[model samples]
Target chain A: MKVSDGGTVLAADVFSSRCPSRSVLDHVTSKWAVLVLAALAVEPLRFSALRRRIDGVSEKMLAQTLRTLEADGFVDRVVTPTTPPQVTYSLTDLGRGLTGHLTGLLGFIQTRLPEIEAARST
Target chain B: MKVSDGGTVLAADVFSSRCPSRSVLDHVTSKWAVLVLAALAVEPLRFSALRRRIDGVSEKMLAQTLRTLEADGFVDRVVTPTTPPQVTYSLTDLGRGLTGHLTGLLGFIQTRLPEIEAARST
Candidate 1:
């Protein structure tokens, strides 16, 4: 979607917020949103697959995160035309951009895991 | 602090946790951590300065966030040996790295504020 000169995308539908950034922060950093983004960062995955990848996320939280991300234009929910319903999720172009940023933060956190542990020991 | 060849930084002191990455994640992604990171991203500031910069943050919450960031080694708490006692905060190299990543996420959210707001309207 093309952003207008004023920075409003497609006339500002339901996804728009007065403080859009705060809303995005709420979603991106929400309880399950970060994990969901990280899980989907690898590849398009089905619901159950996502459940497996994130260490301790519950089904309900997973579903909620997906829904929130979907609404924010950071994720695409694709339903395949098959006998048993098949719904898969992947990052949108916008979503991919977000994933890159979040992953950078996650990567730093991962590498510093030991130091973080050391800091909390006392 | 230099990381050893074994990947343990400075012999893994008090900050160490069983899952250091998870611990860092908890501190970085906590309700107020992100805001604190963002506020400090621009420049080093005193305690009250940060409180004023991040709108809607309470004194108690700000203090708590600072403590958590300091514990994780992401913030440097420099106290001035003055009669009245003065403390200042800034990101460490590690903290700066994390801030860069978090800001990227925050920037994306800020620009997409309109989209997020629009999404929530329904």
Candidate 2:
């Protein structure tokens, strides 16, 4: 993780279209991805529970978003031995670190939703 | 802003497709819109400066994003009555509040670019 060159973090910038952070930004900001991250931030849940918690998310979309999150190192999927083999998904330290702000935004959105709707009407 | 009966925030969940939060989430997470918000969170910038700040955004895209942000109440367009009537774009209070997380996520992505890259290459 030491992407340091003279103490700089390799000059990664999301604003730069060519930068890798740009693509990561795309993944992180995807609507489903954000919802999944926010849900996991509250607590780890099995795939089914997560799908249920995020209303309107199809099984296919949830699986896809989870795979992307897992690839980005923001989520971890674990399987347990059981009668039906339970699978749970949770944010890794990296995911948790990033999700702090996501949850903050979500709360802000929830609080200001009425204002937002008002603005839209006008 | 009080859409509350029992102190509930009207259940405006972004996770629900039918929720107004869904459309709001779409706007917030759009690649260009996110870039615009992140760019503005830094400082108020004119159209040209914003385009420059977010590399590779076409003029049409920038205008469209700005219009959406303005309509969504996340951005304000102020016209300065100078010789040519300069226009500057900045986040509104609502935009600023939500942008806290956007900036946080941007920083996270920038710092962890190397780690994310490593994870992706595998």
Candidate 3:
């Protein structure tokens, strides 16, 4: 348990089912969410560009993930009124804060892939 | 793409469906896996103690999560031939390395819960 600067009593025990942090954790660490965050860390990208960069994500899943991240204050969604209505997504300051942590985790796994694969074989 | 000291070529792009690192990332970040790793960070824990610490985890899920972590070389399971077959779970060196990154992420979420909640309401 921790007391926020705002004096709100905060309990972030992910072990506890009642913790609100668990939902945010789930959303941020979801399969597509991680990939999306990693992709956007480089720069803001349009919906089509994001979809292309993230390999196999379906449009529906990508849209949902962006919405979820946006709601969590980790992503910014900008809509422009063009002939086709351009939608671009980028990391919010909060989202940028999380990118390094996630990318570090992802990079570790990538670098250790050989070791992990060897373990899997045996 | 990066190459290990052992001269093994590594491709850890999680965006690619065929990447082995993707599976490792998924297992390590699974809901129970994160909580289990966080719990084990402080000290080794018996099966029952771990179950109790992680509030709502089912016996089956806990067992499965442990096995997955062990297979990934991130967790060590020690079994003792006791009256009830005492088993303790702890982080391996690899697991310990990841603990800081994960706990940092979790701690951030917990501390920022107030802000996240406010964002949700608006």
Candidate 4:
């Protein structure tokens, strides 16, 4: 329908091909995006720490995912003016809200693995 | 850590590269998978109806997504012994559980579109 932001109203429809929400949804649910959100859910982490926490994620993918999340207002990127220029990433309020749902999905999949595997075999 | 199915215990870890849950998670969260699940959440539909409901999904991608969801025990495929053989796809009990979380995520994204767009413009 219509989403009102201050005085500016926007049409919202994920089912539409031209809706921006489609892209936003894709970014938030991307493989690396889910893992990054999961890792950050534990604690805010620097770039290097984030890379280590998620298995099988390349440097480029991680960077791209973070940028997409940041642009969507789900991630906060802070730069420390240190000798080495440290940057840490954490979930914003919006990001945390989204992460709660993602965490639930992840937990469901993890706990029900046996049932899922059995389903596959049968 | 451990998930027990009857007497057989399974280790559950999505963070590990070798974990089967990783693949399951991928299937559930895949672009087409999410849309297909969402579409089926309404009611059981045949292959053609499902393809029409989701925008921008190709014939090949729709078939592949349905097969993946079925193999994961999230979808049930029923075929009728008619002249042309009618096939219908619907969510299993397990699929319903996961669909709840996915519907929540999709709703959140749809409702927060304005905020996400504002974040991008800033």
Question: For model 4, how does the per-residue alpha-carbon lDDT over B1-122 read when each residue is reduced to its tens digit?
Answer: 46566897768978776688999989998988998998899999999999888889999999999999999999999999999999999999999998999999998998878788889999
Query: In terms of TM-score, which candidate is strongest?
Result: 4
Quote model 1's TM-score. 0.81
lDDT by residue (tens digit), candidate 2, B1-122: 34454666556677767677778888888879988998899899999999889998999999999999999899999999999999999999989988987888788888887788877887
Candidate 3 C-alpha lDDT tens digits along A1-122: 35343677666677677788888888888878988999999999999999998878899999999999989999988889999899899998888887788888888888777767776777
Q: Rank the candidates by lDDT, best first.
A: 4, 2, 3, 1
Clashes of each: 30, 0, 0, 0
Tens-place lDDT per residue, model 1, A7-120, is 655432212334346556767887668878877888999998888777677888889899999988889999998989899999887788888998888777877766655666
Chain A TM-scores, all candidates?
0.82, 0.89, 0.89, 0.90
Worst 10 residues of 4 chain B by lDDT: B1-10
Candidate 2 chain A: worst-modelled 10 consecutive residues by lDDT: A1-10
- Superposition error at B49 for model 1 (Å): 1.2
Deviation (Å) of B20 in candidate 3: 0.3
Q: Which segments of model 1 are wrong by more than 4 Å?
A: A1-18, B1-18, B115-122
Best by DockQ: 4
Candidate 2 chain B, run of 10 with poorest lDDT: B1-10
Task: Report how far residue A27 has shifted in candidate 4, in Å.
Answer: 0.7
How does chain B of model 2 score on TM-score?
0.89
Q: Which lDDT tens digits does candidate 2 get at residues A1-122?
A: 33455666557877777777898889988869989999999899999899888998889988999999999899999999998999999999888988987888777887788889988999
TM-score, candidate 3, is 0.90
| TM-score between model 2 and native | 0.87
For candidate 1, what is the lDDT?
A: 0.75
